[model samples]
Target: MTTHVYFDGGTKNGTTRIDPPFDGDLYFQAGLFDKEERYLRTDEIQVVDGVTYTVFRFTA
Candidate 1:
């Protein structure tokens, strides 16, 4: 099955939203973890309509 993954999808109303959804699973090392420790940093998976999305947030 094909998965729709979105990177740096951005936020909406303080919540992550899938903007310009991608066709497949795409990911990178950056914007995924912290510098000190390799900890997966992201928000809860949200289901909008019937689509489920795993949104990641970068730390400042």
Candidate 2:
């Protein structure tokens, strides 16, 4: 089965969006830009619907 994860930045949203089917790990740092650009590691992203969204994993 596939799992879904969501990261909510709330008011502090980033300009970049990474979408699904990604492999590897993601590293993000908050408050690095004047706007809100999340500094993500190369593995933290995937492409979906022509757009990019961040991927998160659930721990059981």
Candidate 3:
């Protein structure tokens, strides 16, 4: 199964503090999900105080 994580950009430090706590290397399977769900990678994410956040693109 594939897991999707939502990030809150308004968090304190923004997207710069989510990897250290989860260890390094955020790996995923290519065919885990039938459709691609928007999510942020460890390197592309950050947390502030206790909030996490990320940036994403959406279709209109």
Candidate 4:
């Protein structure tokens, strides 16, 4: 069995999409960029046709 993992893939405008492994901890990663916790935003999970992928976006 093989697991799927996606790094920083896909982007547009100022948002970067990342399909993290096993839907890993995103809050932690966002914390890294949001030291001051000013504005933390993420897009809705998107799935590609015929594939199971949890996609979301975060601004850096």
The collision pairs in model 3 are 8-53, 13-48, 15-45, 15-46, 16-46, 17-46
In the range 1-60, model 3's lDDT, one tens digit per residue, is: 112233333231122322323422333222344343233344343344656444322211
How much does candidate 4 score in TM-score?
0.28
Give the Cα error of residue 28 in candidate 3, in Å.
29
CA shift at 52, candidate 4, in angstroms?
2.4
Q: Report the candidate with higher lDDT, 2 versus 4.
A: 2
RMSD of 4: 7.6
Worst 10 residues of 2 by lDDT: 1-10
Query: What's the best-to-worst order under TM-score?
Result: 1, 2, 4, 3
Residue 25 accuracy (lDDT) in model 2: 52
lDDT for residue 11 in candidate 4, whole number 0-100: 30
lDDT, candidate 1, 1-60, per-residue tens = 223332343332234433454433333333444233121235556565677767444332
Query: Which TM-score value belongs to model 1?
Result: 0.31
Model 2 Cα shift for residue 34 (angstroms)? 38
**Candidate RMSDs in order:** 8.1, 8.8, 9.4, 7.6
